[model samples]
Target: MSKIFHPVSEQEALAELPRLRQRLTAKARHAHQYRGTEGKSLMAQAKRALRWHQLFVSINRRACQ
Candidate 1:
């Protein structure tokens, strides 16, 4: 048997957006909990959330392409 390599379309990527958002939201909350409310920890949590958001955007873009 052979595997197929198909291109991902923008519409296909858009279709996955809801699922991705749900996942990222939960992960953000989890990360926030792990970091807790503090000086440095809070800052780290914020940075993580931002990075997750960036990664999510990149994933969507790449999937679309």
Candidate 2:
């Protein structure tokens, strides 16, 4: 099966950003319709960044080992 691939480094982590933000914004807009507070959305973005960083770190570590 084919796996994830990115032509550029910044584009890699930003790949899901648009879709994730859309989904999150919709949910937040529907849930509370709050103004300027992006709790869930920000958390989602942070988690995505953390996961991507962890994945790269793991790949590098394994390659070194």
Candidate 3:
């Protein structure tokens, strides 16, 4: 499958921040709850969390400038 990319506008990024934070929180909670379980999708959750976190930081830095 081909990867899909959509460039985020400043306004769109600002709007997405809250939703992304919420999803990150939920994913984190899921990962924590399954910490000791084997074969869990922890890696996937971590990747998503990282992606959202990076975007969030980038947006904040841009806003501050």
Top candidate on lDDT is 3
lDDT of 1 by residue, 1-65 (tens): 01223344566656766776676566556664554355456556656766765566566556545
Candidate 2 structure, TM-score to reference: 0.41
**Which ten-residue region of model 2 has the weakest summed lDDT?**
1-10
TM-score per candidate, in order? 0.42, 0.41, 0.45
Candidate 1 residue-wise lDDT at 39: 46
Q: List CA RMSD, all candidates.
A: 6.7, 7.6, 6.7
lDDT of 2 by residue, 16-39 (tens): 557765665665556445446575
Give the Cα error of residue 30 in candidate 2, in Å.
21
List runs of model 3 lying over 4 Å from the truth: 1-5, 35-48, 51-65
Cα shift from native, residue 65, model 1 (Å): 2.2
C-alpha lDDT values of all predictions: 0.57, 0.55, 0.62
